[model samples]
Target: MTDVAPARPGPAPRVVLVPGFWLGAWAWDDVAPHLAAAGLDPVALTLPGLEPDHPDRGSVTLEDQVCAIEDALTGGADGVATVLVAHSGAAAAATVALDRHVDEVAHVVWVDTAPASDGFVMNPDVEGPEYPLAVQWDEEMAQGSMRGLTDEQLAAFRQRAVPQPAASLRDRVALTSPRRLDVPSTIVCTAFPAAEYRSYAEQGVPFLAGLLEYRALELVDLPTGHWPMWSEPERLAAVIADRVPRGAR
Candidate 1:
């Protein structure tokens, strides 16, 4: 009888989605299913204080957010690597998780934001049990991505928007593991082209300075307002699905 070879294992197919300020896992509702259809398992998360009914947002710090992401990344099925998708201000929390669990993370997709540098606070001046929506809709509509949304959709968004915790925004980033920089990353740029973003980095903008630490970085431009997930979810999902590690796909 001929000897038989053992079957090879399939790719690690997992992704964790993290949302930005004043939003929850629901923010990814339109995108997650598409990722799932592409053969990747997507886990969308709501951070500690971003919940609409959370009572003690003042005590929720950046560390709390970091811990939540770390747990989600590592707590997946054994031997399966995970990719992290963090939007806006949540990129800081995702970066900390990448730093803490470098080996377990296959890649990171930052939506419209990059990781902040050490000592950088997300929103320092917002003193809040919860920070309220402060943007002027008319100005935002003129220059923002919500131009495609209907009046009813805009009203629904405003109703569902929750207050972000002050502590999470105020805390400075603390990255200990430099190896996190070695992990591959993609920045999905919305509201700006890749060239403009690169220019900002080259011009030494303080916020863009952290991009220097990334050893393997790719910029994917998806021009829309800052919140592409809301305005162009199908396109956003397609872009993200393309970046999922080939093995996982």
Candidate 2:
């Protein structure tokens, strides 16, 4: 008798996509559907605290974002060990949430974002003491008081980039120690810099190398600006599908 491979059990691992600040879950519009085609359940999630409609948009904080994500990944959700895909600013909150609830997150992809570096690591990257240019930098961020898209991209971005609570950026990520978590992570780094803001902006991947677990997940480099989802959705989705949990795809 010929030996055959045994079938895998249980539900397919899910890919939960989180957009950067100023972006709604809709940012993952093109990617999630592609994940679905590849046999992974991809869904873009908007943390509860992110409400564009509210006048007091500043009410939200990083902790609140993490808590909301915690509930979204709450036990008895769709699948086990779900992959958390976060872009830009969301990487900070996603890192905290994963550390807080390790079991819930199987892997996290920091796509064009920071790795939530510990104390000293975060200090140097500070925006400095100027509004828009430096201080009040959080508000200057796209999620904050920054400008939005053109006439064509306006509608879509408006629907997606909702009001992220101000507290999220104000509150820092809590770190017990300067140690890297064992949780698998993938950094889908972009080839082109979104804005020539700072030196490290050009070397984002290299900067995060000190924090991310390069050995754990595949590090993909896409030739595009910061928002690959908007510029090159198909390619971005392909990268995500590959890094998603093995059984997931």
Winner by TM-score: 1
Q: How many backbone clashes does candidate 2 have?
A: 10
Name the weakest run of 10 consecutive residues (lDDT summed) in model 2.
128-137
Candidate 2 per-residue lDDT, tens place, 56-133, comes to 555555677777677666643555557778887787777777767767777777787656754313233433221121
lDDT of 1 by residue, 1-249 (tens): 112233236754688999988788988988887776666788999999888888888888889999999889888877776888999889878888888899988888889888666667777787756676654577656476565565775776788888788788778888788888889889998877888888898897766767877999899988888777778788888777777666454
Superpose all Cα atoms of candidate 1 onto the true structure and report the RMSD in Å to 1 decimal: 5.5
Candidate closest to the true structure, highest lDDT: 1
Q: Give the poorly placed runs of model 2, Cα more than 4 Å off.
A: 1-10, 75-79, 120-151, 158-160, 177-180, 191-218
TM-score for each prediction? Answer: 0.90, 0.71
Q: lDDT (CA) for every model shown?
A: 0.79, 0.60
Clashes of each: 0, 10
lDDT of 2: 0.60
In candidate 1, stretches whose alpha carbon ends up further than 4 angstroms from where it belongs are: 1-12, 145-147
